[model samples]
Target: MIVDANVRFEALSALLGTKITSLSGGNPWKAAPALSVDDFFIQLILNKKTSYAEEFFIDEKEFFDPGYDFDFTNLSDSAACMRGNEPYVRPKGWYRMALKVRGKYLDGDAWLGTNGWRSYSVPGEWPVSYHGTGLEGARGIIRTHYKAGDGQQFGRGIYSTPKLNEAEKYCKTFKSKFTGKTYKVIMQNRIKPEKRQIIGNYWLIPVLAGTSAEEEKRIAESSIRPYGVLIKEM
Candidate 1:
């Protein structure tokens, strides 16, 4: 007896208490009744009654429900990090996410004064002040004391001497390391003492390069939505 693929799929969906449209439309199946979709399919296989339809249906338990149990606390922490308005603690879990290659080197160079002296700023174009992106904003704070000809003070300069050839080379290397590279990242939210305040947020500090393709794919699929300075890849 030949059964229509769609008809069989709909029967499976009904048995699992999920919408037939959801199954046919390729959407993630909602939590079904006590009997999971996988269990239902497995029962059919054991009964030896689904042999005719088995050829068209592949057991896709993983696709239907990736078994990773997400920690609600961790998800809350992630949400808090994105908000940037309160102090949050990092929950221990690796989240999969993507980051777009916006530019090379988090820091940028800026001419400090009319005397041709250049200074290093967290974001070269923007003033190195407190930004509201939680931990990232706190990390951008620079600690340095600069003096001019007479009696003056400023932030740290980019180079002590006028020789910028070596500095340019370093910049190129830094750019090469991150630019045009894959955007996939596995990261965790962290908290650290910044000056006087303890700030927390997801950082790119310990970027995880997964050992295998499966691991990488899992990370990419499960990561949190990128926010703040991290742009989502289109």
Candidate 2:
């Protein structure tokens, strides 16, 4: 399917939080917390009132097996504790909360199927991490197995990088991998960087699926106009 760059940028921009400046000379970016405030509160309550250790129980067969040293009495006590407090533990509401958030940020016309959701530009299923030595290392990985079909949509995982040059390096490497192919990079506004081991601005880079290598190359090289926020496309 032909994904519209402008439409995708609009959707992604709306979901981004406020941009944060980095002290490390990286691009400004935004971040979505791993857990929302509601989720945090629920976890805090669970930690305070519940004994997670009590939820585990050893099988009688394992306890009796001579090959393994078993603490049968302790296991029994833990199981008993879990059963005794079963009524107090509340059901987790994180999944429901996530669904609500997805609905709020996703486009209205996006298809929400039983297995997953999909829009013209975004995939309901998140992409796997592109594990490599550096941003440019993606070229070697893509050259090995990346495939492009006429109708199949492709998504690149979002990541934070302090340097715009690093992101450009990735773009250059990715484009070279698909030399003579057509693809479109839907660039989004840089978001506040998450204060993690790696600190930088977060950006989503999506390439549209193409029919042929030349078409894919064209798509990859084509410039995307900025939407609500200005973004540099390579």
Candidate 3:
């Protein structure tokens, strides 16, 4: 079913804390001016009013009721990474409730500086990465910035993975006192191609061989930016 345009737009605007005006000055989904998904994503990525972003969405189609198990047998490798291990919750087995993220990338910013920049690239062009973080940590990254030095296994940058299953391994679960339901949080990010370093199935900001602590922090923060928060109920 087609979702209401106003409902979608308002939900996004409120989450991102900014007003998102229609490109055609009217609801494109309604008629006259049809805004394609590409155009809609481009507008948010290039809009100069915000440094973070102005888009987010809740997938109504995904089940949110408790104890619902999702089947992942048909998912592609890029969508979910399956693994066999103890405490096994099949990769991407939970329904994706809400994904809060928008396309926003500013040139000459800490995340993507002016060098070797792609003028034609929008946020959608960037590679998708997942960062498993605590609920509180996710909040801090969304409101402010991602704090590095968490799992500096391969260096000193914020750790993330191209595989959702890899990220799931790092997620910390918490039981809500109010609902008695346990949940895990994961932050979805877009990594700068040149700024990230690959090391055996994981992606991290390249903290040069012998860089000082301060420099590593700078690189880590600039190399990756969180765009969405993925929540799963257990």
Best by TM-score: 3
The CA lDDT of each predicted structure is 0.23, 0.23, 0.42
Order of the predicted models by lDDT, top scorer first? 3, 1, 2
RMSD per model, one decimal:
23.2, 24.5, 12.7
* Best-performing candidate as measured by lDDT: 3
Q: Candidate 1, overall lDDT?
A: 0.23
Residues 1-234, model 3: lDDT tens digits: 122334333323432334443443433333322333323322222221213333322222221112222333344444231111101132454333222223233443333222231223333245667656432343222212334457433454455677777677666555544455555645455676677666656665644456654554445445665444455556
lDDT tens digits, residue span 68-172, model 2: 111121222222111111111111110011112223222331222222222222333221111111223333222122223343323432232333333333432
Q: Could you tell me every candidate's TM-score relative to the true structure? A: 0.15, 0.18, 0.43
Model 2: lDDT to the true structure:
0.23
Model 3: lDDT of residue 158 = 50
Find the number of clashing residue pairs for candidate 2: 17
Please, what are the lDDT tens digits per residue for candidate 1 over residues 25-82?
3433233223333233223211212223322332333223223223222333333221
Candidate 3 — which residues are off by over 4 angstroms? 1-91, 94-104, 108-124, 134-153, 208-221
Q: Of the candidates numbered 2 and 3, which has the greater lDDT value?
A: 3
